[model samples]
Target: MRGLLTVCSAVLVTVLTVAGPVPAAKAAEPGGGDIGEALRHVPGLTVVDEAPAPDGYRFFRLTFTQPADHRDPDAGTFEQRFTLLHKDFSAPTVAYTSGYNVSAAPNRSEPTRIVGGNQLSMEYRYFTPSRPRQENWADQLTIWQAAADEHRAVQAFRALYPGKWLATGGSKGGMTATYFRRFFPHDVDGTIPYVAPNDVIDEIDSYNRFLSRVGDDPGCRTALKAIQRDTLKRRDEFGGLATADAAKKGYTFTTVGSLDKSLEIAVIDAYFAFWQYQKQSDCATVPKAGAPAAEVYAWFEKVESLTTYADQALAPYVPYYYQAAVQLGSPEAYDGYLRDLLRYPGADVPESFVPKSIERPPFDHFAMPDIDFWVRTQGRRLLFVYGSNDPWGAEPFRLGPGSRDSYRYFVPGGNHGANVAQLPPDEAAAATATIRRWAGLPPAGPEVTARSAPAGFPDFDADPIMTARPRL
Candidate 1:
């Protein structure tokens, strides 16, 4: 799921303990019954304003522990949660900042529950920047930094909430987590940032190079190409179980097989920059203003299935054919096969190879693999978790220059958001049992199993399961 998180810059904020009266305490949230009654007894929890969310259900931000920003006074200020009173409590905080994943109605599950029983709060913030981020990506950075500073969200939990802990988020949110971990190492305890692509500029530039190299690597490339050919041969005879894009993402395609020969040339134009097509090279495809919409539509229809599995990978099958074709064909043939760069909405109109929101060009080839930069920082604590098969979870993360260690875990055979499915239902429950438990709408759901790391695949790039596990 796209993150219900964004870095809102223009929407200014500074969460002071702004109630009319600095209440010694507030009432427990209503409607939870036994669970609600049980929550009422949780020490330090005080019901604040009942904020309205979608579906007419209101979510009250309860206070467990009072929090304070350890950052410079001028740096910013954020009222802390009320749960930081425990003796061994590290009082961890999970800050989420996603690249493009934003959901107004967030899923009930959160990413941090892996370290079940730890003390912390989930800072459910959102930031959705306008398109054409190229113009304002820098300005947005300040906005992101300010948001973290103003909230002092990370610091409050670490200092106030008690117990060793960690902070984490996925994709864009993961990027935000990575940034926070690095920029304010002292504020957060530990960090598990997933699917965060740093080295943004280098990654984008490397996309073209990746394609070229894949084209050169005969064996691996050919493996994918052969799959593409076989799929093409069988596509007409049998109805497909998936879309063209899905096929590409999963390494499958119809005849003419993999576009390996042509893709290397085309992606250059497709991902060069925002709104602008490539120059110097003629591979960028665009539609003539007068072209019929049907013509363009048909192009998408033909290759649409190719992108179905984009989140997973470039269809390994077609690229397989691409490799074989390149190896078997003459240099002239290979060059001749390069895809044309004409009116690309190639049939691409509202859609194209890689979107601008992706921030960087495709870097499938020159993998700058994720490595753990787990630097135990001054005041950091962590609780990491993941499903064994989760691509995002498998990636390595950097704990920044001075970050702390993590309590990481992995669930075997689990897909993307599998951690929540474990014994402990969601984030609040985990927060509730925290040493100095916070008060809230009766910790929603059951105690969920914490997120964990996979056991094998040691060579995998970012999967920190191996890196953060107890080595003893």
Candidate 2:
């Protein structure tokens, strides 16, 4: 949620006035020609840079003008940035809706590779380059508004790619795909939302319920809770270490109060994070009770970054937190067990993390319910992939009796990183075949070759994707 600047200037002199004024070059118009040329002509769209791509493909970074409020063009406009991975005009297209700022560079999504189609990876509004200059974050940022941005961007490019289209994303992005379909069903032929949650309220109970008994190994769960309790019991020690690291790294903790509170927050989040990313077998690595203080802290640090709540880390995700607070509700804190050990009792809740600078708007209870209703009753050609153990998957989207041509698959023992590719052999084949059929392509054979994702492609469900390289 940061920076970008647009500039313009005029120069005039007595001597230069002798020549007749020249009209500004007319913008390109979409016509029968190369995709690049056609893209340059798309109204309100600008091609920022073209980068290297795999063979048979072309890549270009783009920005599109979008209204701050889709309901009112007079509300002003901002540039929403996105990247296009082009193969052939005739090939299908995957409109990849990033729930946050996209990668710094262009990359292919798994669906793009699987469908062998062009990819349009769009950064969500209020995220860096796509962030609006206006300071009205609360009113401008909503699931519906973000969906409108996607709708316009996709339609803007639809002329060039008349072939079938699919919308896909992971985690929050998966939620975006679902929301986009809810808002504009005709915009894409199908949607594949990976590990997406349908949190219809600010504090969904399913999250805590799921985290309480997620994995098969009760020992692992016990160990994780012990770790939480140990960390909170010795918050000062772990907080001191985290504080030192933050000071050395210039990480600020004002967003979530102080390093002390953040440490407690991390401890509370440890259980959810552990199950979200770690496998049941990995539980043995969790330091059991009575382990050395250093051992506990090290493992805690491994499960969740010490700087996770730092200002530097949280600033980029303020918009996300805001969205969660007001519209897309996040999981409620599962701190009932640690209530006794808690130093900052209620400060660890998700709503508590919204940037202190802005006034938190009341949660729009109807927004998510509306989308959920649409998904269940009217949604078609929707494919959902979720991890059985993922806390976010606790309340997976359920198709209604009236819904048609929609499917949901849960990967056995999968974490948040679940996807169609991760399903069992038969399930994977069925998912792939469904995707192909939706995209108007042929059914898959025994072995369907999916292209490797580009180096810049993100593992949207993974935490390291952020810890290693926080998006702007």
Candidate 3:
């Protein structure tokens, strides 16, 4: 949810295909007996192509014709794209419930790598190749419908692979995985979701609180606010800079009209993105009061550029905005700080974010709230990972005292990229043990290594952020 650009960069332009050895032509259709037979027999499913993947695994691209609306069979069908990086039929499997289109790139799931198992990454319906005709968006985009699509994939794969199965995802993908387990509890043995937020409106309130309390020193928080305030206060100068930059780059802010409005949105996003991605050292770059307007503008660009929300940036994510407005609730941008300076008061509204060309369906607020309750009460064998400084961590699933099987690990000062291996030594070992036990595998070699921070950030352990929640 935080880095749509990073996620979209991995998408492939080609249609689905499987690249592997061809089986003998058969007169009769095969039944669900073996992996190959199951692929050939699964209704509305086809193996387009297959080829050799890294680590002695077979890579496959598949097309699954799923009903537009799972609750109603009469709603028709659409092609859902998925990929399988298969190691062995008997090895443990990790299924990635992608929040957006499943990229055709190599598998990067830590859980899959840590367990040394097969990986199945499925694209969410209504995204790119998996999307239906534009007219069908209203009926096709729903949490239950997406969950149903995953259930179909799991059912097909279970028949092919007899080893233990695990599900995991990050950000909205994590939320997608949680919804899958909620709908079909027996689908996977365990799930590990990273930085997944359960936002029920008022997301800005939590974000505001997070920004106010995040850094080790209060000066860092004050400095961030100063940059935001200065950018807005000098909109004429900064807006001109942004407008010139956009024109030079051939970028257009079609969703929010004028250059001034674009600057405002950029400023708002800069605050969120700064805390969402920046490291502690980056805080030193925040310009002082007397700094040139150009210097401040440069800092804004460094944190989050206005081009990120341009029409080009918004094109691939139209369906995501539609989903967020519908069942998947999104937070309203916090405008209280700059309320007086704002020109387009409605710019931060959930529906306002969707382009005028796309029709926005009425929002169903109850969908996520219902999901939050189900995961808390009945969900089991689930692990959640979050970054303490990350704003999205504000609305995590509420795990009460009785929720024994569910656990949450917060990486102190960690941003959205936080992972289980980044947890403290003792905590990481405990988490690894739980996952190994759940996958029915013995602890062996090839330990999971901690992830390095993105470019410009300090090394992960240089200034470690502690975990927020205790071990369960």
Ranking by TM-score: 2, 3, 1
Q: Give the per-residue Cα lDDT of candidate 2 at 325.
A: 75
Compose the digit string of candidate 3's lDDT tens values, residues 136-191.
66766777667777777776667567679999887778888988886667879998
User: Model 3: which residue pairs collide?
Assistant: 17-49, 18-48, 18-49, 18-50, 19-49, 19-50, 19-51, 20-50, 412-465
Per-candidate local distance difference test: 0.31, 0.75, 0.69
The CA lDDT at 57 in model 3 is: 61
lDDT of 2 by residue, 239-319 (tens): 778878898989987778788877778777778888787787888899877788778778866777756788887877778
Q: How far is candidate 3 from the true structure (C-alpha RMSD, Å)?
A: 9.1
User: By lDDT, highest first, what's the ranking?
Assistant: 2, 3, 1
Which of candidates 2 and 3 reaches a greater lDDT? Answer: 2
Which candidate has the highest lDDT of all?
2
Candidate 3 lands at a TM-score of 0.83
Residue 85 accuracy (lDDT) in model 2? 83
The better-scoring model by lDDT among 1 and 3 is 3
Model 2 misplacement above 4 A: 1-33, 202-204, 449-472
Question: Over 4 Å off in model 1, which ranges?
Answer: 1-57, 60-94, 111-135, 138-167, 188-227, 230-379, 392-395, 398-403, 418-446, 450-472
